[model samples]
Every structure is written in C-alpha cells, then in structure tokens.
Target: MMIYTIRASRPDEWRAQRTLRLEALKDPAGSVAFVNTYETEEAFADEVWQQRAETQSFIAEDEVGERVANVAVLVESGEEFEEPQTHLVGVYVRPEFRGGGLAAELLGAAIEWSWELPEKVGRVRLWVHEDNHRAQAFYTRLGFVRTGRTMPFPLDESRTEYEMVLERP
Candidate 1:
C-alpha cells in the first residue's frame, strides 16, 4: 500500500500550489473540473497565489515528498448560513496518484481541519459539475448527498453545477 503524509500547506508554499493547480488543469477532465482557465491562473499575480495559499488547504505528499493531492475547505459565513460552514474547493488528485485512496485522505484531512476550526462548522459542502459523474460518485461514496440545488456553471451558464453536502454527526 502506498503511504502518504497529509498536512496543511504553509503560506510560503504558493509556488507549489500554483504548480499543482496547473498540473490539474492539464488533465483531460480539467476543462470540466475547474472553472479557471489555465491562461487566467497563469497570468495571476503572485499576490493572488499567496492569498490562496493562506486558505485552509490540505496537501497529500507521497513517500518521496511529492505533493500528490489537495483539498481546500473554505469557511463560509453569511446571513444565509445559520452556522459556520465549510465549502470544499480545489479538490483534486493528480492523474497518476489516483485510485490509491489519496483523494479520500486529502478530503479527510480537510474535513477534520474544518471540524476543529475555531468557528466549529457543522456542515461541509462542495459543488460538482453536472457532467462530471466520476466526481459525483466519489463525493457520494464519501457520504456527501446532493442538495438538489444547482447553479449555472461559472464557465458556461447553460451547464450546471450541483451542490452536495455532508452534515457533521
């Protein structure tokens, strides 16, 4: 079995974050999985990447120390949310490191972090592209259920993105 070390990414690791995102964007499903075009992200200033690096993002590193997966939990706060909530963002596993439970581990790390946050979030949610059945299946297997809520895909309004949520028990 392959062993991975899951940990929070430091702010100074924005370069690593940028590299991983670019790699994910290069994947075949990249066009559907991510809203950001490679060109747009590539053109972002270092400050943008630095801001992202400050988020509560988890990274899974292989035995050789190569970061293989990532999952970021964005804590949501607003009048709409009765309690603090977390939204899963940028969830991805490199094409090569998939199928070894690395994705699950990355998610677990992110969720656990959310659960222990100062805000004490009770719910975690994510958005899955309507056409991305593989991702929907994966989220379902991890106990996430569709909320039946949909939003126009950011990149294509005609397409949809469905909201899925997992309540803390």
Candidate 2:
C-alpha cells in the first residue's frame, strides 16, 4: 500500500489540481461521478483553477507527490433553501487508492473545514448519482443519510441524483 498525505491545496498549486481533476474526469465512473467533462475543464484558464484552489479544497498526495484524491466544500446560500449549507463536491479518488479509507479521509477534511467557516453552516450535504451504488454506500458508511430529495442529473436528465445530508452536531 502506498503512503498518502492529505492536505489543503494552495492557490498556486492550480496546475496540480487541474491535472488531477482531468484525470478524475477520465475515470470509468467519471460519467456519473462528476458533472464536468475533461474537455470543458481543460479549457479553463490558470486563474480559474487558482480561484478554485483557494476554496475549501483538499487533496491526498502519494509518496511521489501525485494528487491521488480530491474533495471540496462549497457554501451555498439563497432563498431556495432554509439556511446556508456546506456542500461536498468534486469528490474523487484514483482507482488505485479506492477502498483504502482515502475517501473517508477526504470527506473528513471537507467536513472539518465546513465547521470552521465564518458563517454558520447548518449541515453538510452531497449529491450522489442514484445509479452510483458504490458512492452511495461509501457516503452512508460516513454517516450521510438520504434526504429523500433528488434532482435530475445535469449530464443526463433521464438519470437522477439523490441528496444526502450529515447534520451538524
């Protein structure tokens, strides 16, 4: 097993972040795991990635310093929801690192960051593709429960994405 270090991403590490994101978009499960495509993300300017890195983004790097996993917490606020919520997004782990508890580590990083935010975040939520049973099971193991709310998958309207939440304790 390869040793991995999990840490927050620096804004200047946009290149590394972009590379890993593109790699994740190419995964076999990428179709349902992510809403962005390699082509679309590849066209983003360096500054765009830099701004993304500044957000609550965390990455797991291998011994060789390759980013093997990533997750981000996005703060969402509007009249649509009762209170502002922290959303877990862009979660991905390289195939070689799967089933090694890296996913849980990534999520823990995001949740920790969420609790430290200046604004009071009521809960942490994530959307899992209804067809992605592996991801659903993984989230459940991490204490996320289905909210019985779903939205159409942006990439495929015929499919659905279920909303899962972990209430703030």
lDDT values, one for every candidate: 0.89, 0.91
lDDT value, residue 36 of candidate 1: 82
Report lDDT (Cα) of residue 59, candidate 1: 93
Candidate 2 regions exceeding 4 Å error are none
Off by over 4 Å in 1: none
Q: Write the per-residue lDDT of candidate 2 for residues 59-85, one digit (tens) a residue.
A: 999999989999988898889979888
User: Can you give the TM-score per candidate against the true fold?
Assistant: 0.96, 0.93
Q: What TM-score quantifies how close candidate 1 is to the native fold?
A: 0.96
User: Which candidate should be chosen as best, given TM-score against the real structure?
Assistant: 1
- State the TM-score for model 2: 0.93
1-169: candidate 1 lDDT, tens digit per residue: 7778999999899999999998888888887789888888989999999999999889998899888888887999889898999999888898777888889888988888888888879899999999999999999999999999999999899999999999997
Model 1 C-alpha RMSD to native: 1.1
Q: Over the full model, what C-alpha lDDT does candidate 2 score relative to the true structure? A: 0.91
